[model samples]
Target chain A: GAGVSQSPRYKVAKRGQDVALRCDPISGHVSLFWYQQALGQGPEFLTYFQNEAQLDKSGLPSDRFFAERPEGSVSTLKIQRTQQEDSAVYLCASSFRTGRDGYTFGSGTRLTVV
Target chain B: AQRVTQPEKLLSVFKGAPVELKCNYSYSGSPELFWYVQYSRQRLQLLLRHISRESIKGFTADLNKGETSFHLKKPFAQEEDSAMYYCARSAGGYNKLIFGAGTRLAVHP
Candidate 1:
């Protein structure tokens, strides 16, 4: 794809429900990242992947937040037992190398936990 | 330990007025800073990086290591420039970015 792509632009989940968001990064991009943006706040790093290797997961807020990039091209972010506090927009970004190359961001998935 | 702070939640200015968005970061080591902008209903995108020292859309940011600041500035604001701006710092071998709360710029005509 010419740009990073995210699926299910908006989602509404009930409390305790599990939801999964998807991201398709630019072709052959070597690094992918996941971020969460709460209302009125900047995007916060959730996890990072160098190719298919999950090199960092330090920013994931809790164990309920899990992200995987099995093939390094596409990634998935899964939230288990969603809570009201989980409502936010989830963004996916990919870079050609690392931070020096800058990043292309997806439109993001706005999840509303009701 | 890596933190970015954008003190202003909103900044309003008339078109053609000068604009400056303040940003500050706290990191012991040398940091890579960037300014990202988001137009209404648009995805966030990079505006400029301290390393690049380039201006985009008439906006420029200079990193001040002594004060730990990277402030975005424009000579004349444009109506189309109204958007949300974020200041970010790369950390952990440039693997991740820590972002500030963001500042909303309203360039009115």
Candidate 2:
């Protein structure tokens, strides 16, 4: 694809429902990242992947949040038992090399937990 | 711990006026800093980086290690420059970027 792509631009989930967000990074990009942006706040790191390896998951807020990049091409973020605080914009970004190389961000999926 | 902070939530200026957007960061290790901008209906994109030391669209930011700041500045603001700006820090040699709250720049004609 021309740029990083995310699906379900917006998601409305029940308080206890589970939702999945998908991301298709730039073709052949080596690194992928997931971030969550709360209202009036900047995007905060959620997880990172190098190829198919999940190297960093330190930023994941809770056990309910899980992300995977099975083939190192496309990734998925799953939230279990979504809460009101989980409502935010989920952004996916990819970098050709490392963080020093900069990143290309997707439009993001806005999740609204009602 | 690495953290980025943009003090002003909103900045208003008339077109052609000089504009400065403040950014401050705290990181014990050497950090890679960047400024990202988002125009209406556009994805977030990199505007400049401390490592690049290059200006984009006449806007430049100098990383001041002593002050722990990387403030974006432009000689004259343009109406087209109105957007949301974020300051970010990259540390730990990872592909993770910690971003600030962001500043909304309003360049009025």
Candidate 3:
């Protein structure tokens, strides 16, 4: 069985540049989540989606960050005007019904902002 | 806000010795806890969940509501057990896992 998968395993962006990361969750999963992990730190919540509906995005660090899960299966995280501080690994995970079922995570996209 | 604390950043033990990686959490309401492990050059994977109460890879963790802790323990640590371990918590339907900084355990023969 396929697990959650991410694209562009690695990316390097200059300061102020825009970048987009993609995530493909397990089939039929209703809940999808995105997290950002800085160097030597644990993953931090960024946004969440249940089906095509974005239930919460409070974890997005700034207005420059945006995420969408239009079909409830694929998700894209876009960061506009990236800063050096934004350099981190972006991880995507999915579960059956949010809190009830365990989540399966992808290898993640390591974005390095210069 | 829910938070997880891993007292040690790194732990080193002999391959045949007992291993214990501590985890503590703080949340106002009842929250589910979990232990996730990441091997070198591999993606992070779930080790165990408090609700399931099952052991994996000879490792076990018990949630102590009184102490607000869930510590991972193995009777005889194996060299394969060396990896990065993270403690996590989930509250409500958020599906947002609050994770600790993580602990790196190294087992030597």
Candidate 4:
């Protein structure tokens, strides 16, 4: 792909419903990251992956938040029992290396929990 | 804990005026600082990093260790420069970036 790709650009979910956001990273990129951006705020790190390995997930806000990149090329973020506070933009980024090389961010998925 | 701080939520500048977006950080060890910009309805993109020490689109940022600041500056602001700018700091080693609340730059003609 020319750049990182994310699915379901916008989503509306009722509180307590589950939502899945997908990300297709640049081919062969070694690092993938997920971030959450609240209204009027900067993106906050959610998790990170190196290849197929889930290296870090310390940033995931709660047990309800889950992310996976089983094959390394594509990733998904799943939120269980979404709450109104979970409404935000979820961004995915890819880097050729460990992100010291800079990142290319996707358009992001805007999730609204009502 | 590593954290980035961008004090101004909004900055308005007339065309050709100088522009500066303040960024500061708090990290225990050495950190990597970067600036990312997002145009209206566009994806976020890297503007520059302190490690590169290079200017892009007339914007430059210098990392000040003593003050823990990495402020982005442009000598002449253009209308096209209107966008949301984010300040980010990478935890040492192979870590993800921590971003600050963004600053919206409005460059008016």
RMSD of each: 0.8, 0.7, 1.0, 0.9
Cα lDDT tens digits, model 4, A1-114, are: 999999999999999999999999999899999999999999998899999898999889999999999987899999999999999999999999999978999999999999
DockQ, per model, reads: 0.82, 0.87, 0.77, 0.87
Q: Residue-wise lDDT of candidate 3 within B2-106, one digit each (tens)? A: 889999999999989999999999955888899999999888889999999998999999999999999999999999999999999986566589899999999
CA-lDDT, candidates in order: 0.93, 0.94, 0.92, 0.94
Window of ten residues with lowest summed lDDT in model 1 chain B: B89-98
Residue-wise C-alpha lDDT for candidate 1, range A15-92, written one tens digit per residue? 999999999999988999999999999999999999999999988989999999897789999999999999999999
lDDT of 3: 0.92
How accurate locally is residue A112 in candidate 1, as Cα lDDT from 0 to 100? Answer: 99
- Steric clashes per prediction: 0, 0, 0, 0
| lDDT tens digits, residue span B1-109, model 2 | 6789899999999999999999999957888899999999999999999898898999999999999999999999999999999999886677489899999999999
| Candidate numbers sorted by DockQ from highest down | 4, 2, 1, 3
Chain B alone, model 1: TM-score?
Answer: 0.97
Q: Candidate 2 chain B: worst 10 consecutive residues by lDDT?
A: B89-98
Runs of candidate 1 with Cα error greater than 4 angstroms are: none
- Candidate 1 has what TM-score? 0.98
Interface RMSD of each: 1.0, 0.9, 1.2, 0.8
> Candidate 3: which docking quality band?
medium
Name the lDDT value of residue B68 in candidate 1: 94
**Leading candidate by DockQ:** 4
**Single-chain TM-score of chain A, each candidate:** 0.98, 0.99, 0.96, 0.98
Off by over 4 Å in 3: none
**Candidate 3 displacement at residue B38 in angstroms:** 0.5
